[model samples]
Target: MSARLGPGRTARTVIGVVIGGLFAIPIIAMVEFTLRDGDGHSLAHWAALFDPENARQYAPIWLGLGNSLVLAVVAIGIVLLLLAPTMILITLRFPRLRRAFEFVVLLPISIPAIVLVVGLAPIYLVIGRTFGTGIWSLAFAYGITVLPYAYRAIQGSIDATDVRTLAEAARSLGAGWGAVLTRVLAPNLRPGLLAAALISVAVVLGEFTIASLLGRQNLQTALVVVSKQDTYAAIIVSLLALVFAFVLLVVIRLAGRTQGSAPRTARRAATAPSARAESPSDPSDPSRKGNNT
Candidate 1:
């Protein structure tokens, strides 16, 4: 006989379905809107986005996509490079400052994007004056925006692992600090790093406030520009972006789950042979008889 779900499980399922439906309705509406035209349902708006013939018309979108891709890469790289080493060092050497580090990283979440833009304006102006208005310049601000997310992800991974023991083991094996970080710690933190990167990419892709206020033409800014002329196509693009972000989030969650299972599996495998070896010997068995003799 199959076991029935308890009231708690049933309630949770109901709540989850409700939440899913609530979130899904907007996407459904957007999809319907994208498919609908004056006469009937159509896909002209979606097709136009990808049609080579309309490249000239969609130049802003293509340019913005390219700019956003660059920004995402640069921003993710900056976040990982900056945070990984710092977090590792803090975990290894400055354990007392961990709380302070957490506070600093999370501080950005409290600061509104508009306020951040206001503060970054002068600094960006100086940067633009020195380096010109390259889109990559936005990566610095994007990195800052994603710091809280990246920090939490990385910190969680660090917390899950025995960093001190791992470092000491690596060191005893003649691994230097660089080798310890790059070869030992980094591999273990792959899930967190991937999660942090995906979050940063999503944040950069959807970011409008900072990029728009800074006069940078990112994906969202370009979508806004397109919306002025062709609202339907803009909606289609927005729906597509939403779907892409959803996929990334799903992947990050799966990665985290996979990472969580790995340590348990490894530990079980490592102990299984030893456990068998230590098991009580059967009295009638040859090994047991020989030991008794």
Candidate 2:
């Protein structure tokens, strides 16, 4: 068996390496350029990113990072909190309504982010004039903007679970709908939520046109502004942001794995005891005689 599989496995490994190299080449070039000097062997560009005058010029770096993270986190939270329950409710209680809701929710994906920003700019202006350009307003926009990704993630998770069975089991135990959702449905959705949050964060972090058009001085917009003055430092700042995003992704994956594993362990524990209790005793047991008699 090992001999027969060798050729196929070797081919797959080769293909995987080729694909990985293709993706890595650009990233390698970017890092090299950012770290390289004009003559090709220095870290001067990276060094300049830390200079006092440079630091003042790049003050937007920390602020933009914070703004981006805040936007991503808040958008993800709102999307999860709003979408999870809505998806569960629709799938459980009003499944037929999903078609209509999906059509509407998906409209944002088809609409260019720039167009959406253009349309929403007036509304945000009105809101800012009244309530100020607060975090909540931006979060709300980000949440709506992210619906295409978040909704699909949530909907896919709901599709994976035995929603009807879980709901019925919970109801049989005298649990309310709230209890059923909180206990039975939400716990099983950690992976999907993490996936959605990651995608949403990626979208919001890289978003340029919307922030530019809306006149929001968020990270991407700030990055553009910095790039105009210091091309090399801008590249370095972007590389740092990319590193931060990678770390965040790794953390999310680890958390998802830990959370995903716990329930399966508990399920096995519950099932093992029940299975042992339900096993047949000796055939000579008196319970058999009761039926015969």
lDDT of 2 by residue, 1-293 (tens): 68685668779799889999999997887798787766766888777878776678888866776787888888888877888778878887898898777767666655666677778988888998999875555777778777765665455455556778888998999999888877877777655666677867876787666667777767888888888988777788788777876775566445544544444422221221111122232222121111000
Judged by TM-score, which candidate is best? 1
C-alpha displacement of 150 in model 2, angstroms?
Answer: 1.2
lDDT of 2 at 235: 82
**True-structure RMSD for candidate 2:** 14.2
Cα lDDT listed for each candidate: 0.76, 0.67
Name the candidate that leads on lDDT.
1
lDDT of 1 by residue, 211-278 (tens): 99999999999999989988887888888898898888777767776774455322221221111122
Task: Give Cα distance to truth, residue 153, candidate 1, Å.
Answer: 0.8
Model 2 worst lDDT window (10 residues): 284-293
Clashing pairs in 2: none
